[model samples]
Target chain A: MKILVPVRRVPNPDIKVRLKSDGSGVDTEGVNFLVNPFDEYAIEEAVQIVEKGGGEVVLVSIGTADCEETLRAGLALGALRGWLVETDEVLDSAAIADVLAAVFKEESPDLVITGKQSVDTDNNQAAQMLAAKLDLPQACFAFKVELGDGKATVEREIDGGLDVKEISLPAIITADLRLNQPRYAALPQIMKAKRKEVKKVSLGDLGVEAKSATKILGLAQPPARAAGQIVGSVEELVDKLVNDAKVL
Target chain B: MSTLVIAESRQGDLRAATYNTIAAAKAKGGDFDILLLGSGSAAGADSLKEFGAGTVYYSEADAVAEYTAESYAKTAAALVGEKGYTAVMMGATTTGKDMIPRLGGLLGAGMVSDVIGFDGANYLRPMFAGNAIATIEVNTPVAVMTVRETAFDAAAPSGGASAVAEAAAVGDDRAKFIEYRLTESSRPDLGAASIIVSAGRGVKDAEGVKQVEALADLLGAAVGASRAVVDEGLLPNDLQVGQTGKIVAPDLYIACGISGAIQHVAGMKDSKVIVAINKDEEAPIFEVADYGLVADFAKAVPEFMEKVKALK
Candidate 1:
């Protein structure tokens, strides 16, 4: 069995992202980029599954050469090897899915694991799109996943609570935030990962349509909230809520 | 062009998300059709007529009773694709987040998730956890979207009844639903509650969560928690209110010991009136709070509870 985990390089979640002056895109000038926080969880889960059972974890990402660093980070974390699907064009969730679907056909991995969504675009779409494109069953928002008997049992967090689902192998699974805490790359492992070269694959070679259908019209800051006034005491706060706001 | 809105219900009762998505459809300024899937779906369809749905497409099948992502996504995609609807919309709930993209991919359509505003052509959605907004445009034949319910006013439940028709059935059993375990609570749902009392990391322990719950019960409000507290295992994940959690916009939101991270604010910033109670006066939560009280919440929350009790 082989596990294929897709990773993405996104702006650091803790940093505030600024929009370009002309409103075309986000400003990455002074921002630091790293493996999308959620994808780290995916990588962690992939490694755990392969370590418990007998399999190899293959990491794949779609981006430019800049993504090799992210792949190496996964390598340090325990992925057997990596494939960087290098493409300079801005691909939407749909286009990215096409590229991954092509890779899925070539690799024929037993499972495809990826983050629920990229914190950057906040578009929780890619994994679902890949599932659709490849005609595979998808278990999303997975908090707990178990692999055995040629099937995967996933506990997914839904609207009200959790639901347990059983999907056969050759499935796509999206990792939720609570899945697992990613471990830090140890110093020796980081040194070893530097020597592990990632294979670079061109987007054009896959022959998948790599253009995004969506367009960004503009970007703006949401309306600023009105500045609040400090109340003298809890009594004043309750009074304000009862008399002024009438919320009580 | 006509629009289609997917109606989601749990255990035969329509959830608030159904109404919110209908409201989003109404924002597009035209008559729209609503699609309801599952057993006893007609009742859900009947309830949705008032939400400006001129027609309801009721889809029922045994497999639709238990929601498998594949089945729901395929059903919706097939319906929207067959109808060639110009716009397909739904609430940005967990189910919507899971299903919308599959529909978009099947139709080769561009999708905007967690949409806050839709002005016919352009969509306004939050980026960087609500620090900035991105207005996007989709040029595909059909536009698929999931609206952030909190960003739009919920559609009214009273209006002229719409016609209901049985829609075509489409699904596959690639996955099986073993069971669902829901957190049973008598209190109002956090997403639709008019008032919310939310606790954060500063609350410290499960006992702290109880104190906040006591305050919430007094006001007939829903209990909410910041992602930090939920992640810390002091509260359940469903109560979490943040970027990755449930987005809510209640009339009054009282933050108890919550230091406002942008992710936390993104979930509740649309609240009509926000009250922040924290010992740290410099917390970013104060910037958005309509009323700020700088005090240790241990002292302040009890004071609030006592005052409301005395007033009652």
Candidate 2:
């Protein structure tokens, strides 16, 4: 069995990002980047499944040369190899799904794991779209997964509760939070990853049509809530909640 | 081209999302027919009709008794394929979030998720975890979209009658639902709660969590927690309110000892009235809070409870 994991590089979640004045996109200059936090869980889950089931884990990231660092991070975390689909052009979820679907056809992995959504775009579409494009079953928001006998049982976290689902091999599964805590790649592992060669897969080679179905017309900062005055005492706060706010 | 809005229900109760998605469809500037796909009773369709959708199409089968992205998407995609609906809308709730993308993919349609508003053909949604908003335009002949319930008002449920039509059954055998475990809580559901009292890392132990819950019970508010607290094992994951967790816009949101991160704020910032109580006066949460109190939650939470009880 072979597992394919897709990782994305996104701005550090802690830092407050600002939109460019021209509204083309977020200002990425002088900003730190890291593998999307959720994607780290995907990488970790893929590594664990391989470690238990006796197969290899492959990491794929679709972006420019900057994404090589993210793929290396996945390799350090225990993936056997990396595929960097180098594309300087920005790809929407649909286009990204097309690229992954093509990879799915080429690699024919038994399973594909991905983060439920990216912190940057928060679209949460790629995994399901890929499943549909590949004509496979999917389980998103997977909190727990057990693989056996060519079948995978997934416990998914939904809005109200949990849904336990069972799907056959050659399926797509998206990881949610609480799936597992990603391990820190030790210094020795980092050195090994540095020496490992990352194969580049280009959009032209995949023959994936990458036209975006949607266009981002503009970007702006969300309206900020004005911080009100600090209350001197608890009574003062309660008075405002009851009278001015009328929420109590 | 006619639009179709999908209706959702849980445990036979019409979900607030059904009405909220109706509002989103109305915001797109036209009336729409609605479809309820499940074993849910006719009351679900009748309730949706009150939201102003005049035509209700439905399909039911034992195979789709439980919601699965595969089955629901198949049923909805079939309807869209047969009717050639111009747009299909649903709320970006957990079910819709998982199902809409699959439906869009099957139809090869352009999709916008978690949309807050619509300007003609453009859709407004958050980016970078709510730090910024982006307006997107879809060019596909058929557009599939999900609405951010917090950004739209719930449509009134008293409009008029709707004609009911039974649609063909859709089927899929790709996956099986084994079981479901619903969170049992006496408090109101977080998404529909009028008031929410959320705790953070500062509330150290299980006892501290109890204090937050007690206050919530007294005020008839739902209990919520920051991701930090939930990750620390101080509360259950269901209680988490953040970007990865539940997004709530209650009338009153009280943050107890929560040092606000952007992720946490993204879930509750749209709250009508925010009150932050933290010992750290400079906690970023105060930046979005309507009222701030710098004090230890152990001392502040109990004292605030007393003040509220006195008001009663």
Candidate 3:
């Protein structure tokens, strides 16, 4: 089984994201960047599956040349190699899906795994969009996935429960929080990752254009929350909640 | 140029989020229709008739009885094409999030997800864990979108029945639904609850979790837990409230023993009123809370139950 896992580079989630004063976009001055947390889960899942079944895990990403750093990190996690769709253009989810579909046709991997959504945009649309673009079956927000008999059984995390779905091979699966704990790359693996091959390609080479179907008008900080008062006792808290807030 | 609202149902009952999606479409100031699919769609269609829809289209074929994105997206896309709908909308529930993007892909339309509000013709959606709101514009001729249910009010019946129509069902050969294992709970659903009592790592153990539940039962509120508690196996994953979990905006949210990580704050900061109780007075959760108490939840919860009972 050859598994294709798409990853992304995002602002380190630990740092508080700040907006520009003019409401244009996020202020990225000195902010650290790393692999999106959800994509790490997808990479780990794919690597583990390949380790057990005697196959290969391949990583792909779209971003500037700096995204090679992101691919190397995935390689250290056990992927055989990487492919970077090098571009600096900001593409929306539709454009991203179109590019991935092009890569799917070129690589012809048996399976595709991706993060449910990037933490920055939080759109949560790419995997489903990609599946639709390719006319493939999809299981989104997968908590547990088992592969055998030319099919995959996925336990999906839905609103109030888990929905079990079975889809044929050559399908799309998006990782959720409980899929697996990602492992840290050891120093030896990190050094080896530096030498692993990462093939560079352009959108033009892939027969896809970086066209955005959506435009961002502006960005602004959310309204500030009011400072709260600390109560001295539980009686006072109840009195305030009942009389002042009337929320009880 | 009319909008189409996709109605969602489970176990033969219409979900409240469908009404909220209608309200969102109404807020956009346009004539909207309803599309009901799946096994019980005919019965569900009857309940949506008075919601001011221009029409209520439904399909109850066995092939489309359950939702598989491949089938539903094909069906919805075909209907959108037949009707020439300019915009399509649904509540940003799991079903909507799972299927609508595929609908957008099939229609080759630009899409937006989890829209909280509108700014003129553009959209308002959260980013970076709700720390910033971005205004977005879909440049496609046909636009597909999902609105956050908590951000809109449920549409009431408008005293007029809409024209009902039957739609063709589409089937998928690549996927099959097996089963849904729902969490059995008598308490109110966390998403729709008016009051929520949430516990944190400070709860310590399974016994501590029961204390939080007891307080929730007394106040008739839903019970929630922080990610730490859920990760520790003291609670089910569905009971978790945070960025990666369920996002709830209740009328009153009482957080006990939670330290208020930014991810947790992102999910609940939009609540109408927030109360935080923890031994550490300087926990970050206190920043967004309207009321803060510097005491251990184990000691304060019993007092809270006693005081609430006396008032009632």
Candidate 4:
């Protein structure tokens, strides 16, 4: 099985995020970036699948040169190779899928893996959109996966319960946090990844132009959370939930 | 046109998400109608009727049997297409983020995941985990968005609602149902709890967590751990309350023995109220906390529990 892992590199999880000058996007002027935590699980899972089942793990990403860091990180974690679908501007989910669909056509990965959602956009739509566009089976929020006998079984999270799903090979699955522990890159592997090939393909060069069917008019900020009223006792708190706030 | 708030329910009662979505839909300041899509969840519709759901289109059929992404997306697309809702709102839980876009694709509607608030086409959402916020509006006929549960208020039940059941256009079996396994962990629901008492590496290990959990139980809160604790395997990944683990907007979020990290704060900063219990008064969490208690957590836990029990 040849597994494909698409990832996003977002600002480090440690910094207080600032908006761009125009408030159009995040201010990444001096923020550290890393592989999206959930996508790390996807890459790790794909590598494990290939390690066990005998195939290649291909790391895929859609971003600018900055995202090369994320792709390289995936390579260090055990992916066989890395590919970059370079774009000038941020691509929306469907547009991203359009470019990925082209890659799918060429690579023909037996199993395509993605994080449940991108940590930055948190759109959580790429894998499903790709599956819909490619007309393939999609199992999402998967915490566990098994592939054997030409079929893949995925454990999915449902409302108040769980439902198991089985799909044929050549399916798409999105990884959730509960899937598995993503390993830290060994220093030796990181050194080796420096020698590995990370091929970058521009959207224009790939003959795929990013055209969004929907246009973003603008972004808004969430209401500032009010300063909490700290009460003297738990009894007062329960009273608020029961009488004042009436949540309980 | 009407608003479509996908009501989330469990064990015949509505989840906090349903109420949050309802409050948001009403923010449009118009006639509100809700769609309850699930397997044999008619009770959810009945309970939610008092929330001024002028109409309830409940789906009861094989299509709604389980949360198959294909079925929900197909059915939701058909519903929105046929009824022509002003907006199709969903709870931005794990399920909504996965299913909404598929529905958007099926109906050829515009998709926006994790919309905390909106002014016309512009919507508010978080970036860099939850440290910064962004607003974007889509110029599309149908705007399908996932409601950030932490951002909206739970709508109160009001008068009455007219409920109707419809056969789902999408069949549950349209796509194959995959295997699902549930992992049970010790910590309380980081996102849904009223009081979340979290510990970081300062707590030391599982035994140290027991000290924190003991205090949490006395206070009727859930146990949460920092990413550091989670990274050290002192707790499960689900118990990690941070940008990467679970972003909880509970009523009262507390930190015990934790030196606040940005990732940890990003997960709980939106909480309605906060208290920090740490030795270091200068911890970043204290900056956002409404109340600060500087003391040795080892001593603080027993003292706090004693006070709580005495109050009780």
Candidate 5:
């Protein structure tokens, strides 16, 4: 079994991101970048599956050379190899899905796992789009997955509940929160990761075009709430909620 | 441009988010239709007609009887192709988030997910959790999108009855639905509730959670939890409100013992009114709150319940 995991490099989610003054995009000037938090769960789940059964886990990423670091981090987590679709062009989820679909045709992995949504865009669209492009079944927002005979049983996190579905092998699964706790790379593994090979390819080399179907007009800070008063007691708070806010 | 709004339903009743999505479609300024797929869709189609849709289309074939994206997306895509809809829209519910991109792929269209508002021809959506809002435009002839339910008001009935039509259902053999297990709760749904009382890590334990629940029960509000509490296993995943969890904008949001993490604030900052009670006076949750109270939740929650009870 060969499991393909796609990782993305995103601004560290701990720090609040700021918009550019010119409103073109986010200001990446001094921000730290790391593997998106949700993608870490995908990497961990893939490695665990490969560890249980004898299989290979391959990591793939689409970005500039900076993404090689992200792929290497995944390799340290136990992936056997990495592939970087290197491009500096800003692509939307649709373009990313198209590129991944092209890679899927070449890799022919038995399973594909991805983060439910990138922390930066929060679009939550790529996995489903890739599944549709490949005509493959998909289980999105999965918190529990059990591999079976040529099939995978997945428990998806849905609104107000859990939905369990069974999908065939060679399918796509998007990782949600609570999937698993990702382990940190040990010193030895980190040292070995540097030796692992990451093959770089351009979109043209993959026979895919990086075309965006959506255009960003601008970005701005969200409207801020007015400063609140510090009520001294619970009674005062309740009164303010009922009288001043009229929300009670 | 002709638009199609997908109506979501369960147990033969239309969900509240469907109304909100309809409101979003209406805000887009066009004559729109509604599509109802799956079992128990006829009743929902009938209710949807009251929203002044041009037509309410439904399908109940065995293939599309259950809510699987494989079948539903095929059916919706076919309908979009047949009618030549310029746009397809739905509420940003779990089902919508799962299926819209598939529909977009099948149609080769551009998608804008979780839209909050519209500025002329461009759509406004939050990025980096709600810290920044981006204005985007779909460049495809057929656009696919999902609107955040909390950002729009529920559409009111326009009293113009719409025509009902039956549509053919398309099938897929790739995925099979086994079962759905809903969290059993007598309280209101967190997303749809007007009042939400959320607990945080400061609540301390399961006992603390119950105290917060007691306050929620008094006010007939839904109970929410911070990601920290949910990670600690104090609450179920469904009740978590944060960047990675449910985004909710209720009329009133009360955060108890939660330090306002940016992720947590992303989910509830759009709420009409926010009240925070934390022992830490400098908790970040207070920054976005309309009212802040510095007190131990253990003492404050019970007092809140008593005070709310005295109101009735």
Candidate 6:
């Protein structure tokens, strides 16, 4: 079974966001990047699958050239290999899905895995779009999965509870944070990943290298928050809410 | 001139999203009839007559009672193909996000999610998390889009004139819901709340959440938190407001001690008024905040409360 795990390289969640004065985009200069936290679950889930099933896990991503380093990080974590579909700019969810659909056709993996949403874009569209494009079964927000003969039983998260779903092989599944606790990479694994090779798949090769129809017009920053002066006690604070804010 | 709208219904109740879809259609399509699909939702469907829905279509079955994206998409696609409706819309909830792409593919329509506004099927949505907004033009005839709850004001629940429209039986063999769990809140939702106050990792501990709760209590506002704080196990998942969490569009939002990640901002940027309180004015949250205060939050929070309390 070939398991594909596609991830996004977003700014480290631990790092504070820096917005430009015009509120157009984040200041990426001199910023550290890491695997999207949600994607970490995808990588971990894939690794666990291969570890149990004895097949290989292949990690993939469609992003700018800088993401190559991030892809290498996936290799260190335990994927057998990596694919970097290099592009000059970011692709919208649909365009990204188009590229992935073409690649999935070639690879013909038994299972496709990706983060439910990217920490950067947060559109949460890629996996379902890919499933739609490929006409494959999809189970999203997967909290757990058990693979058997040609079938996969998945537990998906819903508003109030979990739903048990059974799907055939050759399906697309997107992982959420509750899916799994990703393992931390040891130093030895980091050093070993330096030697692992990454197959750089260009957008031109995917046959859907065209620019997206969506146009980004403006970037905006979140409005400011006012500092609250702490009262002497919690009791005082509650009173303030009742008397001043009149909300209590 | 006829439009097809999908009213999101669950557990015998018509969701707030149904109204948003109607508002968008009234503003986008000159005429539209709403198609609401769910089990035990006939009364909810009948309630849509005032919202410009000329007709309401509902199908209820034991299996369809639960929200299955595949089943929802499949059923919606069937109606769309035979009826040849102008467009299909869903709320961008957990179910909608999973279901829309499938519907788009099934109906061969283009999909736009988290759209704040639209004009003739050309829609605007937040991209790069919330750092930037994109306007996408879908050439597909049956336009499929998800409207951000805050993007458009919901029209009055006058379905104008509505008749019961029959739909095919609900069949969702691809997915099934064996069980579910939820974190139901008694207070107003953050998206619907007029005032909101949220805390972040800067608060350091669960005890710190009290300050947020107090502030929210004072303002009669909802309490929210950054994903980092939620990840820290300081709050429930529902209290999280961000890209991976709940999306909000309150009239005023006060982010306390949150440095502001793009994902967090993406969820709350639609709020009419934003205020950031942090010791580091350089924090990205200040960029979007209409008001910024640089001071020790511990000190500032109390002072602000005093000023607010004095008004009483």
* Highest-DockQ candidate: 5
| Stronger candidate by TM-score (2 vs 4) | 2
Span of ten consecutive residues with least summed lDDT in model 5 chain B: B8-17
lDDT against the true structure, per candidate, is 0.87, 0.88, 0.91, 0.74, 0.91, 0.75
* DockQ score for candidate 3: 0.83
Q: Which stretches of candidate 5 lie over 4 Å from their true place?
A: none
Instruction: Estimate how well candidate 2 is docked, as a DockQ score.
Output: 0.82
- Stretches of candidate 3 above 4 Å error? none
Ten contiguous residues minimizing lDDT sum, candidate 2 chain B? B41-50
- The residue pairs that clash in candidate 3, if any, are none
Model 1 per-residue lDDT tens digits across residues A20-76? 888788889988889988888899999988888879989898998999998998889
Query: B169, model 4: CA deviation in Å?
Result: 3.9
Clashing pairs in 5: none
Q: What is the TM-score of each candidate against the true structure?
A: 0.97, 0.98, 0.98, 0.87, 0.99, 0.82
Can you write out model 1's per-residue Cα lDDT over B1-69, one digit (the tens) per residue?
Answer: 889999888778888888878878877777789998887798888777766677898866786777787
DockQ of each: 0.80, 0.82, 0.83, 0.40, 0.86, 0.30
- Quality of model 1 by C-alpha lDDT: 0.87
TM (B chain), model 4: 0.88
Error of 1 at B92 (Å): 0.5
List clash counts for every candidate, in order.
0, 0, 0, 17, 0, 37
lDDT of 2 by residue, A150-218 (tens): 889999988777889998888999999889999999999988998777889899999987777888988
Native interface contact recovery, model 1: 0.80
lDDT of 4 by residue, B1-312 (tens): 477888765434556787888888887666766777666567666677678877777776766755667777777777777778867888876677767777766655567766677666567777556655665655567777888777777888777656656635576442576344544655456656788888888788788888988877776788888977876878665677776566787777778777878767777887766777777766766777766666667876776666556655
lDDT of 1 at B270: 89
Q: Which stretches of model 1 miss by more than 4 angstroms? A: none
Instruction: Please tell me which model should have the higher DockQ, number 4 or number 5.
Output: 5
For lDDT, candidate 1 versus 4, the one ahead is 1
